[model samples]
Target chain A: MAEHDALTRERILEAAEDVLRRFGPQKANVVDVARALGVSHGSVYRHFASKADLREAVVRRWLEGVSAPLKAIVAEEGPAPQRLKRWLDALVTTKRSKRVSPDKELFAAYRALFDESGIAIETHVGELARQAAAIIEDGIARGEFRPVDPDETARALLDATTRFHNPAHAEEWSDPGIDASYEAVWRLVVAGLTV
Target chain B: MAEHDALTRERILEAAEDVLRRFGPQKANVVDVARALGVSHGSVYRHFASKADLREAVVRRWLEGVSAPLKAIVAEEGPAPQRLKRWLDALVTTKRSKRVSPDKELFAAYRALFDESGIAIETHVGELARQAAAIIEDGIARGEFRPVDPDETARALLDATTRFHNPAHAEEWSDPGIDASYEAVWRLVVAGLTV
Candidate 1:
């Protein structure tokens, strides 16, 4: 049992990630994860109550990998508008890379897990939107952007720019003229916010 | 064959729409449409050629219903900028009203047909984008909006506002705050395009 063995739990998670990567989320099982780490499947259950829980943890880890950097960007010292632009650029690039250029298999895995791990994903989106809201709030305080409810603006921004950054729109993101599309969206955002 | 009688062909299509509406894309076959119209199934085939063709025609008719009003708006006498706003506002309203109000059943039916009627849907999207481009081209020529390529800007605009009008995002659009979200998006579009 991993009840008191935190290291064993972490190791199992690492092994689970590897097994999932190798076999994919749909085909990968807890027994396969345990086999990857040379442990019985019972110990895996000691750490994660069920297969669904393990999938949720892996998806949480992947989503955290994305939002953590944005949270840091929100905290960084800079002009709010510029920081917002940089943050959005980072979000787009990271999403595109995850979804298309480098690791589509993992992205595909995440997409499948997202529906299964609904609460984990819902929480992650809330955190990211809050980060956007924080940046908007900062911009308004500095008198650089228009006065609007930061939370509403954040949702609007996310919803409006969904195609540019959403994984579901990955195919369109790779179109020959996608850069122009991104620029047009950013121009609109900046124009709308500038005092 | 009903081909020689234009009125009969129209009557068959009207009955097909009714059958598709009632039984939906999956259950509504050509035979069902013919049964609804009290005609021989062969007559339905004479008009549509195949079940796929019948579905495509139904989807094309549905999509045309959405865009025909916009085409008129594009041709109406007005300043380009004002017309553009009117066009977008009209788009959001029509899309929302169709998606949410009395005909949600039909919207669901269309979503089902959209998958089955891919070419029809693709052609419909291209036509809508061209309509947007025509409005943008007029605005650019009138010197009311920025000097951007009408076609690219039209794609960008459609991409940006997709969530508000796209069927995939219909659930989110029903959120209580959707009106505010639509207003925020319009503000950005108008601000970004103003000379």
Candidate 2:
């Protein structure tokens, strides 16, 4: 019974993701998710107690895409500087794809939901910053970066690259020559971080 | 008639700003502005052809408060590094005050207006970038910084410090110890810009 319930819950979440992409967050509800999964409303309720609870779970799934891959890069690497550069590129690519992806509606829905719940947003950012701090720590120990406060330097680096990574600057991401501009910013960042 | 017309137009704009702050952009129509000014809707329309024009004007006025004062600081007499630091601090201060002020509803209304019309936001950003570039050029000329591309470097500096200035990060702005984080970020920025 436990195994069956877990599978059913995962199936409902997958269906809910599909439903959210089609209808924005405001309109996507438990009923629509159940219909998509070909399950009764009572079955979805057995899995997720309320629509709010289901939306939060969907947000967690959405966040995993951005959080999981970057954490991996930070842990597995030949050199800290190389890992940091790749990490920056990964962050920019993740944000850029989400902004222009076919699931842009889903992206909007997730942003709206996350905005309503500050802890989720804070936790997501805190995780990213923590990952960044780890890379900075690696660089310092290897003598690649200056011996600055790792936490502060990580936040600075993140803020510096925000135009490429932050959702608020998403529209500017599509501008002509934005790639060159991004490279210019990246070069300055690497220069700053290097001793 | 032209002189009186100019005075009447200015009066309409002042009243429109008041109405926008009190009622927000969506509901602050020409009629409301006219009522605030004790004038007719036709009078407001005579100055602004449509509701869009009126909203755009209000956005421009809101931007001037942030842009105008800072431009003078860029031209003030001081070491380029000191000027740059002050400029960075001033931008953050302006944005923070706007976020927490009792007129925060006014701030939200302006953001909504600018978001709908990208031109307003772009113009505001372009002007600020120009000011930063000027400060960078001064730093280079004064032998205080390396021979990097001033325009590109200025952009990098602005993007790096965005957490302090951008409205999207407003929630994080209120975080405990945020000011110290901002200063730490500022130190890294100055270290990067200086020779």
Candidate 3:
């Protein structure tokens, strides 16, 4: 029974993500999500007390997916500079993907989520900053990157990459167009940090 | 008479920007703008055919303000590397002002403008591309920059700068803080384009 309940909840969350991505946060109500899932609204309500609950869940899911790859890439075997460069490319590619279908909804939904008052996005933002900072600091320590303030370097890279990740700038993204730009970003990181 | 007409147009555009920045695009109607100006809605309409027209004028005004500094920086006597760095910093600063404004309305208005259809943003984007390309080419010619495709470099720089300019990514805007991240941007630009 618990297993079935978990499956139902997962299904409902998936349906909600679809609705939020397609229609936006304002229209991603219980009725719309239920309609998308072909399930009763009660099913959604059972898993989530309200629309806000569901929205938060979706955000958590997105953060997990995005951070997973970065963590793996950092752990992979390669020179620090190469790893850093690939990481930059991966960041841009992920951001570009968010500009495409289905993910656009996630992007929009996250925008709305960020705007909600009392929502502690600081925790999430800090986590991201910490992860990025660790990578640069490690690279610097290994002599694969230039030595600079790890926190500052991490923050700069995050700002550059996150700006590219924005949906409003969606029109500007193109494949292979930003490769050199990404290289520039990695070089900047290395330059500023290199001992 | 022409001068007066031009002045009125400028006043109306300024008023529109003020209203949009204060009340957002949806609320920056002719009625509100006229009221703000202590004039009649007819006067507002005289300068602009509709709210959309007013909004366009406001955007044009904003773009002009942004471009003015860039043009000046480009024209200033300096190596391409130094001028380009300053130009990138200027671009980031201009973008940061809009993103970090306490005026939620202005931010939303900008978002609405991005959503506008049939709006010939191509001219604006093209002009930016040209100006940036010219700067890069000049740098290359002067031996201050590496020999890369100037046009491609400009497009990449503009695209990346445009990403930071977006209001949606406002959260990350100050995380690394605008100034340092921009330094990182310039470093990357120089690294990729420098001979």
Report the C-alpha displacement of residue B130, candidate 2, in angstroms.
1.6
Per residue, candidate 2 scores C-alpha lDDT tens digits across A1-195 of 463465476788888888878887785589898777666788788888899888888877777789999999999767787888898899889988986679788778777787776677667878898998999899999998889888888877777777788777777788897888778777777776778
**In terms of docking quality, how is candidate 3 classified?**
incorrect
Better of 2 and 3 by lDDT: 2
- Clashing residue pairs, candidate 1? none
Cα lDDT tens digits for candidate 3, B1-195: 453355488787777778778767776677888887777788778878998777777777766677777888878877888888777778767767766548555766776875673353555666667777888889888987767777766766765554465555656576655555666655644655676
Over the stretch B101-127, how does candidate 2's per-residue lDDT look in tens digits?
A: 787887787777777878888888888
Ten-residue stretch with the least lDDT total in model 1 chain B: B1-10
Q: What is the DockQ of candidate 1?
A: 0.51
Give the Å error, residue B194, model 2.
1.3
TM-score of chain B of 2: 0.93
Task: Name the lDDT value of residue B105 in candidate 2.
Answer: 82
Candidate 1's C-alpha runs over 4 A off are A1-8, A22-32, A49-52, A75-82, A137-144, A147-149, B1-7, B27-32, B75-83, B100-105, B116-119, B134-148
Give the runs in model 2 whose Cα sits over 4 Å from its true position.
A1-9, A26-35, A38-53, B1-9, B27-35, B39-54
Best by DockQ: 1
Off by over 4 Å in 3: A1-58, A94-111, A117-144, A167-195, B1-58, B95-114, B117-120, B167-176, B191-195
Position B31, candidate 2: lDDT: 83
What tier of docking accuracy does candidate 1 attain? medium
Output the TM-score of candidate 2.
0.85
